[model samples]
Target: MKNLIILLLFLFVGQQNIYAQKTIKIWVVRHAEKDVSNPKDKDPDLSPLGKERAEALAKYLKGEKIDSIFSTNYKRTRLTGYPTADKTGLTIQTYDPATHSELAKNLIKNAEGKRMLIIGHSNTVQEILVAFGAQKPVKELTEDDYDYIFELTIKGDKREVKVDRYGAEHHTKE
Candidate 1:
């Protein structure tokens, strides 16, 4: 009986490892809404509504097992990640905007089957999407836009891109 129990335990562990290797979910959020009204606000921070949105975003993501989080060197992106990181206990990685596409590629390579979140700007996010070969001209996402989650599913040599846009929305290029 003991031998049978040990075999069962081993099988459970093996199944878990297999699942870990099969799938990864990635959440890409445009930085929260910024205070663009202030001409003096050279470096715009999250506006009041933006802060609330961040809190809502945190609540929505609280239960997910997010393995990694990333943000631009900018304060807005870093701040946008704060709530999620605090909830998930993951530190946000800062990457340069100029080299963002390369950095994103490296991230996908290293992430393997683990989930990751990358927070970025309107322009930089476009480059990131291009790097993933998900789409071209990746559509400059803005603070006013809480677009959708870019879900990439990888199995062996096959990769698929699906967008789970907010409010079940979809985008078509002009």
Candidate 2:
């Protein structure tokens, strides 16, 4: 019995080390609120509230060694990545929405062995999530909703992603 217990403890410690080494995390967030000052209706930069939220997000990600930053070819998404990128010294790569799938595929290919943060709009986030092989589909996420954060972990052929609602609880999807 003593030998058996020792063997099991050794195996548990070894497994923990392997799991720590192989784990990778990705954080996906919607761009912060936008300015509506331009009554003429053109895309504007982040509003004051948006700037505050962006700063909050930067603080939230301070310690993580973010490898790459990816965003859509839009001002909002670029602005969202700015504070974090400034802190981490990671350059932001712009992906065109017209070729969303292609951009997503290339991102996953290039991000192998590295952690990435992707900022996108409400409409585009779900599409990219699907491209990443995420099984659950968010049917209705609006611009006012800046709540859901998608956390994804990929190792070899296996993929796991969970949705974390900002005001609520995190749930793992099937």
Instruction: Identify the candidate with maximal lDDT.
Output: 2
Error of 1 at 86 (Å): 0.6
Q: Point out where model 2 deviates above 4 Å.
A: 1-24, 165-174
Using Cα atoms with residue i matched to residue i, what is each candidate's TM-score against the true structure?
0.73, 0.77
lDDT of each: 0.70, 0.75
Clashes of 1: 0
TM-score of 1: 0.73
The local distance difference test score of model 1 is 0.70
Error of 1 at 52 (Å): 1.3
**How many clashes would you count in candidate 2?**
0
RMSD of 1: 5.4
